[model samples]
Target: MKHVTYADKALFLDDDSADWLMEYARALGSATMTDTVTLRGIGMDGNEVEATFLLNHSTELITQTTQSGLQGPKNDEAVGYMQEQTRLILTPPPARSVDDPLEIS
Candidate 1:
């Protein structure tokens, strides 16, 4: 499990979830954008719960491994989505040509 500290709140998430969240935050910062994301994680009581975070250029997120005996929540789909979003931000698609053959007159 990993601990993600944002502002004054800390959330315990799985390794992938925490790592991808950090990377996505960096990408969002580079793009000068803002977004809200929620991921399943271990709450203060060691039970599974959803934690939300706001990512933006001025926001900061920290992650670190934890030795808690509780198993972290598995959020593969959310992790994948965040990874893809980060990729898109870091490597955006090429712009379409205005004079392309497919353009309608």
Candidate 2:
């Protein structure tokens, strides 16, 4: 498990998920955009819950390994979305040519 600290709130998530979040955040920051991602994790109270994070260029996140024996929550859907978003941000779509209606000869 890993402890992810964001601003004043934090969540404990599985290793893969934690890593994904960190990478996704970096991608978003590089693109200078913002996105929201929800993941299943353990809160400060030691209870499993869904946490939503708003990632942006100004966002700051810190993740650390934990020694807790608890199993991290499985959230394949969220992870997949994050992966796709990160990929898109890193490799954006190619620009298309716009047809102009006005022609001055």
Candidate 2, residues 1-105: lDDT per residue as tens digits? Answer: 999998899889998899999999999998898999989999999888988899999988999998988898988888899999988888877765687455579
The 10-residue segment with the lowest total lDDT in model 1: 96-105
Tens-digit lDDT string for candidate 1 (1-105): 898888887879988899999999999998999988889988776677888889999987889888877778798988988999998999997887888666478
Q: What is the C-alpha RMSD of each candidate to the true structure, in Å?
A: 3.4, 5.9
Best by TM-score: 1
Estimate candidate 1's RMSD in Å.
Answer: 3.4
How many pairs of residues collide in model 2?
0
Off by over 4 Å in 2: 97-105
TM-score of each: 0.87, 0.86
Give the C-alpha miss distance for residue 17 in model 1, angstroms: 0.2
